[model samples]
Target: MAKYDYDLFVIGAGSGGVRAARLAAMAGAKVLVAEEHRVGGTCVIRGCVPKKFMVYASEYAHHFKMAEGYGWTVGESSFDWPRFIAEKDKEIARLSGIYVRNLQNAGAELVHGRATLLDAHTVEVAGRGRVTADKILVAPGARPWMPVELPGIEHAITSNEAFHLEELPKRIVIAGGGYIALEFAGIFNGLGVETTLVHRGPNVLRGFDDDIRAHIAEEMDKRGIKVILGAQHAAIEKTDTGLVSRFTDGHHCESDVVMFALGRAPYVDGLGLEAAGVELDEDGAVRVDDYSRTNVENIWAVGDVTNRINLTPVAIREGHAFADTEFNNKPTTFDHDMVASAVFSQPPIGSVGLSEAEARHRLGKVDVYLARFRPMKYALTGYSERCLVKLVVEAATEKVVGCHVVGPDAPEIIQLAAVAMKMGVTKTQWDSTCAVHPTLAEELVTLREKYVPQGLGQAA
Candidate 1:
C-alpha cells in the first residue's frame, strides 16, 4: 500500500466527529481529528449543555415562588446572572476536558486548527503539515442563522449570545417561531425579563401537534409572555433607553435587546467538499445515504451537517452508524423513522411517531385519548396551570401511532413514551399495564373516554 500519514482523518470535533474519531481509533485505525476551536463541539460547549443549565437556572425562580405553597419559605429570591454564567462556564470547561482526554486515550491525535481539504485524500492545516489519510469523515455540525433585512440588525443575538450575556437584560424581544426562540423566551421571561416573543407564523412550534401548540400558547400567555403572532421584523433601532423593534404590521415594540431564533444553517462554509467531490443539499447540508456516506467514495458526513432532524441524539446515532459501517466494517444501516424529540419551552412539549394529523391523513382512522387537568402541585401554588396528554392509535391495528404531551415535566414524562413508541408499543399494552397512582406520568394510562374518530382534529 502507498504510504499515508493516518488511517482516518476526521474534521470537526463536535459530537459526531469526536465519537467517530475515538471509535475509529479503538477499531485500530490510526486517527487524527482536527478541530478549530474546542474538542467538545457546539453541544458540549455552546449549545445543549450550556443552554440546559440556563434553563435550570431560570426554572429555579419559579421553584422558589412555588416553595411558598409547599410550606417552605424561600427568603430573598434573588438571582446573580453573572454567577450563573460563571458556573455554567465551569461545567462546560470540565466536560470539554473529558472529551479531549477520551480522544487521546482512544489513540486519536487531536489537532487544533482549521482544516481545509486539499484533495480527496489530502488535507492541509492552517499552520501545520499536510495530513494524508485513507478515509475522511466530515461532521462539521450547524450554527444559527440570522436575517439582515431588518435595519439596525446589530442589536440581535442568537442562542450563543443568549447563554453568555454578562448582565441579564430587563427587557428583550425574541424573533422566530421555532423551538430555540420559544425556549430562550421562556428562560428569559421566567428570569423576570419584560419579554415578548414575535413569530411570523400563526403560532410558535408550528411543526408540533396543533393541540399541544395551542395549549402551550395559552400557557405562555398566562405566564405573562406577550406573543405577537403573524408578524415579521422590519427594523430594530437602538435608543437611549434600550431598543425599539418595528413590526411589519406597522406596530412597534421596545426592549433592551433583540434576539433572532430564526433558524440554523449547516457549518460547511470552509469545508472543501466541492474539491473533495462531495455533494450537498440546496441548503448547504452534506447529503448522505442511510450509511451516512457522501456521494464520493470513501468519504462520509454525519450530524447537523446533514440537516437530518438536527437533534443531538440524531447526530450521535448518525456518527455511530457511520463508524460501524465505515471503520468497524460491521456495515449497519439505520432506519430513522419514528424519531422522538422534546422541546423545552415553558410548558414543555414532547412528541414521538406520526403526529395526530399525520396519522389521520394516511391511515384515515385513529383513536385518540386526551387527558387534561391541573397537576397536583399547581393546586398548592394557586397557579391553575393545566397538564395535557394525548395518544393517537391506529384504529385497525390498535398500535399507538403517536404520543404528545404539553405541560410541566412533559419532557420527562414523554421520554418514557419515546422509548415505548420506538419499540412499536401498542395501546393495549399501554392500558393493560398497571398505573402508578397520583403522579403526573400515571395520567398516560388513566385517560377517560376511549376516543374514536376520523375527523380533521378529532384525533386529538
Candidate 2:
C-alpha cells in the first residue's frame, strides 16, 4: 500500500494537469485532480476553442462578399450576437462535459475548488480541507493581463469579456500588437464593427519575421481595419455614448468598446507554490528544468505556468512526458524544437522553426526562396488577396531551417512542413518530392530560384 493517501494530486485541471492526472491514474496510481474554474482550463474553456469559433463566425462576412464574384446571389444577411453566443456556450459546455467524463473513465477523482499546496505533499482545497499525495503536479496555466496605468482601465474588456459581450459594438479600439490582439481586431472588423488596432510598438507581431509583420499589416489595412503604430492607450473615459480612448501620442478615438489583448501572465498567485518551496522565474513563471520538474522533487509544473511553450498541444505533450517519466519508468522529456504554431487571424499565419532574421544571424550565409501568388479559389472570385510562401535554408548544408506561410489553410500546410523539418529534410529533398498539382502547397516545393544578396553578385 502507498504511504500517502494518493499517489498523485494535480492542481489546475487544464490540458496539462488533466492529462498528467488521467495518465497517472491509468498507470494504477491513486490520483486526484482539482480545478477552481471549468475543468478544461484556458485553451478548452476560454481561449483557443472559443476564440476559434469566433474566427469561423467572423469569416462568413468575407465569404458573402466573395460569393458575389462567384455569381452566387447571396441574400441580405445579418449576424445576431446573442444567437452566436448561445451556440458557442452550448458547444463549450459539451466539451467541458467530455473532459470530465474522460477523467472519470480513467479512474481519476475530480475535486472542484481552488487548491493550494500546504506543504511538499499536502494540498488544501478552499472548502474541501487537505489531501496528502506522494507527488504533485501544478499546471495552473495563465490569465489575460491588462495594463494598470491608464485611468478607467476597468472599463476596458479583456479577451475573456469579449466572448460574452451583450451586443456587438459599432466601433472598437483594441490595444496590443500580439496575436491575440490582432486576431480580435480581425474578428470585430469582419463582424462589421469599426475596428482600430493600436500598438505601442512600431509594428504588430513584434517577434515574427519582418516581412510577415508588414504583410499582415498591409492585409489588415486592405480590409479597412485601421492600424495605429507606435502609440498606446494613455487613458480611457466612459461617455454617455460609450467609451473613449486617448493615446499617448495625443490622438484620441471614441468607440462603443475598448479591449486590451496585451498579453498573459502565469496564474501563480494564491497557488501557495512559495510555501511549497517551488521557485519561479523573473517573469513569475514556475521555474522548471528541461524535464518539467520543479525545485521540489515531488512537485512538477507544465504548460503556460512553466512559461516553456504556451501552446495547448505543448502542454499536453509536457503532461504526457511527466506521467511517462514518473509512472511508466520511461524517462521521457518533451523536445521544444521545431514546434509548429498558427494564428487564426483574418487570413491566418502558420510558421515553424527559426525566423529568417534569426536564422541569418545565427547561421550566416543563408539562402532564401519565396513566392507570392493568388490561390485558385481567389482567382475565380476575382479576389486580390495573395498568399506568401517562404523557405529559409542554411546555404552551407542546404538544410531547410525555417518555413513560413501567410494565407488560407496556412496552418495545415505548415504542419506538414514541421514534420519534414523535424526529420532534417534538406532543400534538395524538398525539391525532389513531386509537387501536388493545383494546390497552394505546391508553391512550397516548386520554388527554383534562391534570393541572392543585392551587392554580392552585382558589379563587385
Candidate 3:
C-alpha cells in the first residue's frame, strides 16, 4: 500500500505549481493541485496576460493619430469600457479553462480549495479533509501591497482591482515608480485618462539603467502623464468630487481613482508555513535552495513565493527544474542569470543582463554603446518619440554584459538580444552582424560610437 495519499501535493495552481504538477504527474507520480481561486494564477488571470490586452486596447488612440499623419482619413472612434471588460473576462475564463484541462490531461487531480500545511508531508484543504503526500510544492505567488495604515486607503485600488473598474476614471493618481506603476500610467494615459504618476524617488525604475530611466520619464511627460518626483502619498481623502491624494510635501491631486502600485508581497500569510517548519526570508518570501527545496526536506516552493526573479517565466523554469529533479530522476537547476524582462508601458521596455550601473559597479571598467532615433513608422507623424538601444560591454572581456531597449517592440527586440548575450557574444561579434536596413532593431548592431556623457569619465 502507498504510504501517502499522493506522491506529490502541490499548493496553488499558479504557473509554477501547475507546471510542476503536470510534469510530475506525467512522470507517473500521483499529483494533486489545490488552488483557492481560479485555475490560472495571477499572470494568466490578472498580472501579465490581461494587462497586455489592456495595453493593446489602449494603444489604438495613438495609432489613429499616426494613421492621419500617414495621410489615412481615419473616422471617429471611441472605446467602450463595458464591452472591453466583457471580452477580456471571457478570454480570461477560456484561458483558465485551458489550464484546468491541461492539468486533467496530464493526470493531475485538481481540488478547488485553499491548501495549507498541516505538517511536512500533510496538507489540509479548506472545507476539505487533510491529505498526505510524499512531497509538497508551494507556488502561491504574490499579491499587490498597499499601506494599510494610510488614512482613507480604502478608497484606493491596486492593480488587482484596476482591471475590474466599472468605468474608466476621468483622472488617476498612481503611486510608486516600479514597472507596474509605470505600465498602468501608460495604460490610463493612452486611454485618454488624465494620468499623474507620483514617486518618492527622484527617478522611476530604480534598478534600471539611468539613461533608460531618464528617457522613459521624458517620454511619459510627452504622453501627458504628470510625473511627480521626490514625493510620497501622505494621505488619501474622499470628497464629494473625487479622491484627493495628498503628498508628503503638502501638495495634492484630486482624481477619480487613486492606485497604490507600491509593490507586491509574497502570498504566504495564513498558509501554515510555520506548521511545516518552512523557512522564510526577512521579507516573508519562502527560503529555498538552488533546487527549490525548502528547509523541510519534503516541502519545496517556487515562483513569487520564493521571490527569486519574480517573473512568471522564471517561476515556470524553477518549477520544471524542481519536477525534473524530483520526479524524472534528472537533477536540474535553472540558471537565473541573463533572464530577459519587459515592461508593457507605452513604447514598452525590454532588458536583459546587467544595467550600466551594475556592470560598472561589479566589473569596474565597462564600455557603453547607446543610440536614440525616431523610428521609421513615426517619420511622417509629428510625434517626437524616439527609440533607445544600448549595450553594456565589459572592457576586459569585451563581452556584451547587458542590453536595454525602450520604444516600440522593445520587448521583442530584447528577447533576441538576450540569446546572443547568453552565448557570451562580444562587442565586436555583435557589431559584425548585418543590419536589417530601415529597422529600429538594426540600430543595436549599428551603434559603433561609444557614448560618453559630458563631464563624466571614460567608463561611462
Per-prediction CA RMSD (Å): 1.8, 1.6, 0.8
Clash totals in order: 0, 0, 0
State in Å the error of residue 35, model 1: 1.0
In what order do the candidates fall by TM-score, top score first?
Answer: 3, 2, 1
Ranking by lDDT: 3, 2, 1
Alpha-carbon error at 77 in model 1, in Å?
A: 2.0
The superposed Cα distance between candidate 3 and the true structure at residue 289, in angstroms, equals 0.6
lDDT of 3 by residue, 1-460 (tens): 9999999999999899999999999999999999999988999998999999999999999999999988999998999999999999999999999999999999999999988887898889987789999999999999999999999999999999999999999999999999999999999999999999999999999989998999999999999999999999999999999999999988999999999999999999999999989999999999999999999999999999998899999999999999999999999999999999999988899999999889989998888899988989999998999889999999999999999999999999999999999999999999999999888999999999888867786535
Residue 355, model 1: lDDT of 74
Most lDDT-accurate candidate: 3
Query: After best superposition, candidate 3 residue 156: deviation in angstroms?
Result: 0.6
What is candidate 2's lDDT per residue for 125-157, written digit by digit as tens? Answer: 977899899999999899999888679998999
Task: Kindly give the stretch of ten consecutive residues in candidate 2 with the minimal lDDT sum.
Answer: 451-460
Query: Which segments of candidate 3 are over 4 A away from where they belong?
Result: none
